[model samples]
Target chain A: MSRTSSDAVVVHQREPFLRGFGSFVADVWAARTMLVSFVRKDLMIRYRGSALGIAWTMVKPLVQLLVFSLVMGYFLGFGDQIPAFGFYMFTGLMLFGLFADQLTGGATSVLWGAPVVKKVAFRRELLPLAAVGGALVNFTFMGVVLLLAYVVTRDFPNWHMLGLAVPALLITVLFGAAGAMLVSALNVYARDVQFLIDVGLLLMFWLTPVLYPWSTVQNTLAENGAPSWAFELYMLNPMANAVVAFQQALWPGVDEAVANAAAQRAAGEPFIADFDYFDSAFATRLWLMVLAGAVCLWFAQRVFARLQTGFATEL
Target chain B: MAADVLEPGVAVSVEGVTQEFSLRHEKTLKGLLVSRLRGRHPVAERFRALDGVSLQVPTGSTMGLIGHNGSGKSTLLKIIGGVLTPTAGQVRRRGSLAALLELGAGFHADLSGRENVLLNAELLGLSRREIAARFDDIVEFSGVEQFIDTPMKFYSSGMFVRLGFAVAIHAEPDVLLVDEVLAVGDEQFQAKCLGVIRRFQQEGRTIVLVTHNMGDIEAFCDEVTLLHHGVVRAQGTPRTVVAAFRGLLAEDERERRAQSAGGRDDPEDPDLGFVRVARVVVRAGSGRPLDAFVAGDSLVVEATFHAERPAPRFVGTLDLYEGGTLLHSTSTARLGVPVGPLEGEVTYRFTLPDVPLGGGRYRIAVGAAPDTGSPPWHQVGDAAEVMVALRAESSGPFALGVTVDRPTRV
Candidate 1:
């Protein structure tokens, strides 16, 4: 608050290479209050006039869970063998919804706040960060719905659920923030990127094991005589691994007989899979995914900083 | 004042700051790719909006930037405000800063006026606690108390600007950057806003204002900088800088007139060259041609037309303009005045029995056209310049006679 010092703030050309990254981090940290305000405003304005308001957050995922469960569990008869198919699908859908929302929202964050971005001098990264943060808030609301589903079904979560779910959720958010940062910056130059992302998210939703489990993918690969590297490459998708991690945390008591039967029925079907929740190799791969996500976050921050220099002109 | 005396500080210092923007001709990847396939490189033309401009602002003085459009006055202000970063050099500031770079720049239309006040204040760098403490005062200052809870989309533009200005001034930053936002709103509100800014000046806050209004620059600024083509052309006390700015503007206008006159040899419409407006003269009712006239005096505007090819009929139009705003316009065709067939030269005159205009510099524009659905044969803007002197104190575009009456002792 003191205004008398001449040396308090100096803005100069950033140092070349990675040296300025540290200062960038420090700047973002200093503007954390603005970031929080942005996120709060984003969430409030989004639901301001809606009758359902914040309830729409929970309602969207719940509806997605019911529709997927009804189609895959009844008509398709794929979920007949998976015990508590609805809850399993809900966990994956919840995580996927959070990831998708963050990605799309992050991509448009800068463009959406063009008025502020062009006129105000602040940490521009806060825009995408707020977008991801707002998605996380919605994710928390859906988490409550998940908890409610657990109580209704008389299924209880153990301490291991906390141990695993918290890290899974964090990793998902980190991945989302990274993706949002990259796409949002790209979106400023190419409006086509927004539409590309819409199509990409649809493809990614099917690619990830949101409605199904991971086992079906593996079994189908084995049956098709595909090489093992294909399955490894498939597992390398961070969202695929994150979805498995979320399922493991939320639906640990899946009936194996029913799961296998559903797996048998879902053979050769797109987006139907049964995951191995306790696979040591999958856990290791999930850890690697988290590390990769962190690296991506770092890279995205650098790209965003470089692109943001021209945001005012571009906007 | 205490801080200024204690520190003798420089509030803002710009050192060799240059802002370069890459103007991309192709914004889409597909367009870029198509250009690549055609053996052409997608071009990004670099423009230097601010070219190594450096200045030092003392802690407690108000500085005004004056320039024509695209002269980079706003760019310099933005750079100082930190809304834009220079591509080279550096900027150092002594204290917290708030910028009114654009009025209502970030207010959400769907949000109520009260909500936008909080949002805009915080965006300007005020903390939530500070905004909460000063909310009532901000609202009162804006005079939008009745519409505080109404969505901003429903509010008038004046209300929006008032609220935006109110929040910005209340932010109490050490350095304030304002960019022509005072040009909006009513006269009373504009005066109120300027009063707050004057108060800020008295409190020793550093202010940098960008405006095209020479009056404002003279009235408010301790010093002035006049920019031309992204560089400072003049910098000194308000009087010297404003004079230089006006000189530059007049020079520009003269060059533009020369160019336009040279280029007008080829008429767009073939029939337009049949007749041309040669001269325009303005005279008082006393029959003396004068450059300046007093309000309520009878004025006569006469335009002479020379016809190269005989025209069957013609309509002469006269227009009076103050600055860019047209005050009054009349056409002989509209007034049912008859016109011309025979040709060498003809003079048409329109008389205003009482010039109702208030004091201001004014221009007379004259044009002539074939009366039968053809484009104007010749049109001349500012064919004659006249100054209207105020007979008495007045406001607005015109002065009307007023009668004051006292209430009867019923």
Candidate 2:
């Protein structure tokens, strides 16, 4: 190791923001290797004692998909009503899994790292970021299973429609990362934040359109004489809009099934009723959520920086 | 405080630093609520662990911080290490720094020792390549190579700290803050650690060590600071500051004994007798108060006494002790000088023609008793301290002046 010169000196002062946040940014960048090491440690610790090890990442989700397909597809006969119902549900669940894992892991990250945080002086934001990194690693593992399903079924997505998945994935990730940073810092002060996070995630799971299509919710709201603002309020949930976007990108059967229903009705033939799956304002909602998520992420980082000063003493 | 730049050659400069912590007595919500319902509210008490402490450690120099427990020695070290941001004031430090506040504090118990080494090194700001280069040296020094693949939980506590110490020393930090961690491991390993510290000194790396062991402070430190109740009481050469710290400890001990003695009401106890040694002072033969002296100098011990009732025969004994070992002792009875039935106040003095003592701090213990072999009516274990300097050519507890005989071969 070479000697650090006098110009590269470090000053530990209270409220160092006056010296500029640039130094903090530089410090974090300098510790990038430690970030990678922490992410690897988190991933390794999760599977350390398991018999199947990383294979369990694939098996666990595959089993959840099977159980969901059996209960919601075969028993409810939605397998016949909707084309590729299994694919649509699987893609939505995968995205939701990413969001859930990021939130839970991020919120409890500081508590799990009590030893290192209390003992070592480093960029503490790395702890939650590492958790988010670990969750992304798991997301990639599940994506492999989804790709194989697409290959095995021979039902490829519309290449143009698949481009929409980028914004959808960004929305989920931005919100997840933001929530993690905010909750993790708060959790250090009061452990109750994690339990609150658990309840919030459970509520968010049902609010997201994973188990059913967006049209089902739209039709139900219409029948209840709900106002237009009520529908707009539902779209305000970034996770809901992201889920709808992912389905538009990855699920190919919705457009064809809707066209088939219209043609049969025009011929005066007995046809099963089906609603249009596309949302006219989908693009606008996606951009709006993305902009909202950026603001949220910036605010969360500020909150984390403020709270982290107390972490060493409190822990 | 002005943000004055630290002068060149100063590795660490802390100015008017104070650390305040809000101590919460109740941590759980349930416990808090129950206590509040009973009309007891646990308010956060602000405790200042360090109060406006300032110091400068010169680059390439070793500084020792000596203080009693809770005297802010470790807190000051933590502030310098950047482990805890001071509640007030600023710390400016040059070059890369590493703190060995607690050994193996970053280790994961479930991970293998090899994995922990990599992870801990990264946590301490070592790059991957640097760790790879030093990995073998660390393992060899720790002496746990055969069990490197095993989880640290399987290793003994001694092995655990050795591995921690090994990695930290090899980090080659420009400035290292150590908090009494060298006391760990076996004696042989401890010696190895001391050797490493000496090598670091030779390399001109700055080190700030906080320890209670005065021997280490004297042997390794170029400068020492004594802290009492979160403030610096003295700072100077290791010998002078260490002597001042010992004086502080003695004063604290005496105050504690006095407090406890007040609670005891044993009238028959000889310690409560009327005859008492009022004050004791040690000085050189020239009538100067003894701060220090060259070896073999004449010494004078004076004691003032008050007697309400005294026996016909009495004894005034003075003892010179280096630590707990009594080096020399004398009494009026042994000298054939009579200190008889006395009243009111009297002064007793003893003069030694020549003193043969080591180059270390010694304490003067004076006592007054009515009869021989009876409990002392008044005794001051540590009345005054005198520092003796050894001759340049001599070593050990006694400065025995010896002459080498020059003669023809017989």
Candidate 3:
């Protein structure tokens, strides 16, 4: 094993694992229809025979919004004062849900489909991508629920925020596929990875700006002169940009003119002013997330190709 | 005799393929559980599953792959099929190859038989148009038409096998590879599968078959390779290769029971043996084919003598142990069968049908008798192995648990 990560592991002692061009490309591509059918089958099978069936995709997000609005709106005291707090949490929840869903679903796709992986040779990458796509399909219902919420609320969501869907899907998919590729390869050699994902998900859930706002965390870190390692969490956390973008999209002008006025008034004087520095350029965060997602995806492709050779025997 | 023309192009070529497996021994069950749960270094040890295996299959030729268990027969097929990648070696294929190493490798249970047909056909590189054109024929051939709409999870094992086989043969590839899938279908289905293979043979589609069944080997293969312990021990025509296979089986019997060849001293393995040890071995036919047993073929048992000094007149008992328990046995003392005087190297040729035995592994026990005064024959050594094969089922003795009780006197 090389110290640095490599996509290809050309083992010369034995016959190569992914030997010929016909199998490497054609085998994967030949299974294109199979991949589509399998992805469709997975979706059908997942929601099959259930009372709500796929309605749960929308219902789950709506239910979260209803309960959060009651608790965060009345109890926590951030009611109408913070623009659209209900929409704020809904956007965060939707984006965050995508990130979590992609990672969990994609990460386990290969292991979950060990039957196909071990028994035959097709594109192993398709398994995880199918998972990402399944979550993507479920996004449609969630869209309807978000639209319904926007109609019910007075705050009109701007058309600019509609861009979040594509980038969110792409970024979440890239990160999700990367995570899945890495974890699926790792899980073949270790059976206890399910438990590892359980812990990792729980920790990352609170760490990401899902239930709360980034302002909450940024305010805490700004109080201390030394910016913490937690700052990099924004870069690494896949949901941070998407979630913040959604909140910015649904709730227009969240941090209003008060902070800018105060900053200009205090600028000539020898006093520092508190303003929304990170907020001024929050849309770029989603773009950065897209870039990060692509990077992870590229990294994942290389990693998976190298490690996938070990899967047949390892499984 | 069949024509011996091989097409110019190579359908499949394997060059210097070697597959190594890491056998984790340092981590026993206890160690593995301890380390894995504790998050320590996972233990692994290297094992060479395949070593320097190379072969070529010219287009439009029937090649037979024969090997004993653990001989890398399946591994080689998987690599050729691209289901498995070799740790080292290169496999080159010119055109599309439909590898049937295991039938229905990609079938889904939740999908109906009809649905699976499309999925499986598409998987075999068939276009939707092709699958649609062949749908009715595939359904009719599978004979699962009535149950086509039922989820495959509800399919009977035989129905599942039929559907899989139906989809596979219809897919039609330039190179067809078949493993032991014929064993799953009924006699009629097996015959039909063989017929399909014969058609492929006639069409000049390359076919490589891996089967323990000599019937399949003799019937279909124009060329054969016999493998032993991951090495090509023999390669030639079926007749010559099978003869070599029998020779290898006999050699394997000899190697396996090298310990109990009528031992002169106390057997050292305290754990495996202690009961006045003797020997164990299988009676081989003239050619010594492990998979060759016929209705009245004369089978011979070769044994050497072992006894304590001042040899007692011990009765020679041959008990057949099947599945670790005695099924039926005979002794020289209780002879309806004849037992001649003992010599240095004794050989007994018993008619195959005389034993009324079924198929399976039977241990040969040759125990010694004591003089009338001595304890009724202290046991000598106790180890011998024999397998009965029926011409009907060359895969091996199909008699799984059919035990014959010695005809008790009325």
Candidate 4:
């Protein structure tokens, strides 16, 4: 084995504020193989002993869809009002599942990797990043299951709007990564952060447009005489925008419901309400929020870099 | 900070590195909030583990760090390995580095040995291609090829440590930081590890080792540094530095004995100040006072006693002990040596010819009795200590030299 003359010489000290970002990013990039190893380990260990193995990943989402379709479609009498209501609801929950998995898994990533973290010297950010990777794998499996459901029902989604899901998933991942880095580092100091994240996620589930579509929230706000900025503020949540984007991509009835509402309004007949999937400022707000999420992720990474110097000692 | 400029031969240089840890009094958030609400601020207790410690390891040289527990040897090693960022100062090192701080520290119990080796080698800064190339060599060296696919939780502790050490040694780091992890597994494996370290030295890799086993230090270290209470006490050749460490240990033992006054000083003495054994000393045949000696060397024991009043027929006794067990006992009367009427201070000398002792510290005790079958006027336990180094390649409480004639088909 030949030793490279250009071997990097590292100088370790207490890093000043944002001074070592370039080298830190370089180190993270260099350790990408380790990140893949950790992600693979997590996925393999999660389903090592089960009878069905990786089939378990698809089982949970299918079961949830089955239960929701039975209770919400047949028992609630709303199946006639909305087409494929269970699938629409399942589409929103599927993306939200990715967010929730990333949040909780990333929050405990550092603590869970304590044995490796305390002994080895590598880019510690990989711990939380690996958790995000594992969540994305599960998200892929759920996406495949959703596609099969659409095929069985013979209701293809809007092909033109499906490209929105890419940016929507990107924003969700950014937000998840930001929250993960922030809490994972803080959790090393105080274990209460993990519990607080659990409660916060429960609250966030209702606030985001997961169980109900964005139109119901808009209808409620209009009836309550809320200001227009209130509508903008409600849509400011990244998860809310992600759920709407998923609906525009996967749920086939979004445009039909909008057309039916317009026709009913012209005839002066009672009709189920549905909002425009693409609002006037939708693209601008979507990309702007992506920018905002990137800024939050950068800031969280800085906080993580500063706090990680104490992890070995504190843990 | 400006970049450091190292001398040509220096591979690792630590400049005034100081590490301090703040130990928080409150462990939980709720407890911290409650204490703050009561207007009682729980202060963080700061502990300085390493204070202004600076050392340089030249390329291809092995340096050993020796100290009592909590003396910051491991902390310094961690700082050098970049596992910890020093609170102050900087550690600059060239080339790749790996720290075998704890065997199997990076292994997952649930993962198979093969998988763990892949992960662990990558964690130690090895590339995927490098690990794949050396995977067979690592498994062969570890001697666990039969169970390479089994999860580590099922492996024996010895097998686990062997595999961990095997993977780390194959990482091909330019500088290695080892912290007392060499004395794992059985003796055969330890020797194998030592052989690998010797090969590393031959290949001109710098090593910084931390261990309490002075034998390992003396055997492997080119130079040694002694740390006492987070400060470097001495640094130089292994012989001088290890001697200084021994002196420090003896001083600590003296201080501990002095603190437990009840055991060192007899309180319920009826003949309180009538007579007392003032001191005891051990000397070589050349009349030189030495705390260490080779086995089978002539030793002279001298005990000085002081009497306030006239006392006749006083008997003096000398006892040699090893760790609370008495090995030999002799008295002036037993040896046919008589003492005069004791009125003032008197010194009694006992000569031992060709003593056979093993490699360990032996304590000497002396006492003065009024007469045979009478309570001792004064006695001192742990009066002095002498270290006996083995003369031949032998072990145990006594070093015995043996000879065997060639067997002729008997």
Report how far off residue A156 is in candidate 3 (Å): 2.9
Instruction: Tell how far residue B360 is off in model 2, in angstroms.
Output: 7.2
Ranking by DockQ: 4, 2, 1, 3
What's the best-to-worst order under TM-score? 4, 2, 1, 3
DockQ, per model, reads 0.26, 0.39, 0.15, 0.54
lDDT per residue (tens digit) for residues A1-315 in model 3: 111111211221131434343333465565667778767877776776799887877777788888978887778765543556676777777766766676667666777676556555566778777776777777666767777766776456656556655666666667876787677666666655645776897787778765665655765666665466666565467666556556655554345423543655677643222223355455576678888877777677666777777776776
Chain A TM-scores, one per candidate? Answer: 0.90, 0.89, 0.77, 0.91
Q: How many residue pairs collide in each prediction?
A: 9, 0, 23, 0
Per-residue lDDT tens digits of candidate 4, residues B147-246? Answer: 9999988998789888878887899788888887776788888889899889989998989999887767866899999989888899998767877786
Write one digit per residue (lDDT tens) for candidate 1, span B1-410.
Answer: 22222224778887888888776667777966776688763335678888878888888889998888988888887778777778887777787787877665466777889877887787777878998999999999999999999988899888877887888788888988888888998889998988988999988899999987776786799999888888888999986786677568657764654456533232333443467888887778865455567667887888888877766677788878765578888788788876656378888788888787676667777877766333465677657666666556565568676666898888
Candidate 4 docking: what grade? medium
- Where model 1 places Cα greater than 4 Å from the true spot, the runs are A12-17, A158-162, A255-282, B1-8, B35-44, B262-410
lDDT score at residue A234, model 1, on the 0-100 scale: 82
To one decimal, what is the Cα RMSD in angstroms of model 3 from the true structure?
10.0
Model 1: CAPRI class: acceptable
Report candidate 4's fraction of native contacts.
Answer: 0.53
DockQ result, candidate 3: 0.15
Which stretches of candidate 2 lie above 4 Å from their native place?
A1-5, A8-10, A13-25, A257-281, B1-4, B25-44, B103-105, B263-410
Candidate rank order under lDDT: 4, 2, 1, 3
Higher-DockQ candidate of 3 and 4: 4
Q: For model 2, what is the alpha-carbon lDDT of residue B53?
A: 92
lDDT of 2 by residue, A1-315 (tens): 344346434456444433435555686688887888888988787898889987776676678789878877889776676778888788888898888888899988998888777667777888888888888888998888778878998987767788779989999888998999998998887777788899998898888778766666666787789987787777678999888889778886767767866886788864344535445666776888888987777677777877887787888
Report the lDDT of model 3 for residue A22.
36
